[model samples]
Target: MPHADTLTVVHHDDTKTRYTDVRYQLIRDGIRIWSREGEHSLTDILMTHAYRRREQKH
Candidate 1:
């Protein structure tokens, strides 16, 4: 399983219809950690994890 602190989130919007569908994905080291389809806000996704780590400068 992907480490909670190392996961990065990506948001995508599907506008194939009148309404927009949002997709949220958490990825770690080029691997998909989690994915879901819905109308979730970025703040909602960030708040789900309490121990998120900052991206390291490499």
Candidate 2:
């Protein structure tokens, strides 16, 4: 597992359409490990993380 402090999440949005282009990022040791774009529901957050983690293993 990554360090506790390394698993940080940041929402990067530069416009009023943050909801439209919801870019949520997962960072580890100052590097972006996973991210997703576009409007997404709160429930999708968990699914997105799991999907990215699985993809990273490959």
Candidate 3:
């Protein structure tokens, strides 16, 4: 999971139709775990923890 200190930037197109992209940067002890583009959901964020665990095994 992203630390509470994580910084996230959400960008939208001029049309305001939908979220065009999202940028996430981890600002604490660990490397950035997930920085995805395009639309996303709460589930996606939650799933990042699983991904992080997988990454740590490498």
Candidate 4:
């Protein structure tokens, strides 16, 4: 079995530009089994993570 988690992050640049980041992770047995991260939308990150999980089960 696996567990799923999502996180939102922030970064500030020298030019005072702020960025929001989305990250998704699949963990098993207290360790991270898979991860997807980028500046993408939350919906995209979740969908991609789900697809990858299904593929790995076969």
The CA lDDT of each predicted structure is 0.33, 0.28, 0.30, 0.29
Candidate order by lDDT, decreasing, is 1, 3, 4, 2
Better of 1 and 2 by TM-score: 1
| Superposed model 1: Cα runs more than 4 Å off | 14-58
Shift in Å, residue 51, candidate 2: 24
Worst 10 residues of 4 by lDDT: 43-52
Worst 10 residues of 2 by lDDT: 43-52
Model 1, position 31: C-alpha lDDT score: 26
- Which residue pairs clash in candidate 3? none
C-alpha TM-score for every candidate: 0.17, 0.15, 0.16, 0.17
Which is the leading candidate under lDDT?
Answer: 1
Report lDDT (Cα) of residue 57, candidate 2: 55
lDDT head-to-head 1 vs 3, winner: 1
TM value for model 2: 0.15
- Model 4 residue 21 lDDT score: 32
Candidate 4 residues 1-58, lDDT tens each? 4333433222222122222232334333122223343323222122122221234665
Worst 10 residues of 3 by lDDT: 44-53
Model 4 clash number: 0
Quote model 1's TM-score: 0.17
Please give the RMSD of candidate 3 to the true structure: 11.7
lDDT of the structure predicted as candidate 1: 0.33
How far off is residue 29 in model 2, in Å? 18
